[model samples]
Target: MTDDDPDRDIRCQDALQAAYRELVSAAIMAGWSEREVVLAIGELADKHLLSLETNDNADALIALLRRMT
Candidate 1:
């Protein structure tokens, strides 16, 4: 898979953290309460995972699923 593909499982801990930070910033700017912001971020992550093709990164997806449990 190309390095840019999210399902390629490229090391993305830093990128994910940065993205979460940006989400928090956007939530605050939109006047969302902290709880609402957290829930929104969770939904965003779920949606992102839902968009990926299953065969593109089984290992990475399994690890992520493990963490969710």
Candidate 2:
């Protein structure tokens, strides 16, 4: 992956995720089920990867949080 490569953005993202795999493990260690961890990671899609309807994702997060209580 290089600056000129169109897939560089996503390539670097994968590399970063590999480096952060421990963080994901830590979330699971903290008692978060795998499904909850996946949902939390999916939330980051709106924040970083796909920026469409950001607020809608946020609203859904809030709703999920409310349901947890």
Give all candidates' CA lDDT scores.
0.79, 0.83
Q: Which number leads on lDDT?
A: 2
Query: Which residues of candidate 1, in runs, are more than 4 Å off?
Result: 1-11, 53-69
Q: Estimate each model's TM-score.
A: 0.45, 0.51
Model 2's C-alpha root-mean-square deviation from the true structure amounts to: 11.8
Identify the candidate with maximal TM-score: 2
- The number of clashing residue pairs in model 1 is 0
* Tens digit per residue, CA lDDT, model 2, 13-64: 8889875688779999999997888888888865775566776799899999
Worst 10 residues of 1 by lDDT: 7-16
Question: Per-residue error at 38 for model 1, in Å?
Answer: 1.6
Q: What is the lDDT of residue 18 in candidate 1?
A: 83
On residues 1-69, what C-alpha lDDT tens digit does candidate 1 reach at each position? 478787655456655788878878888898998889999778887888876756558878888999999
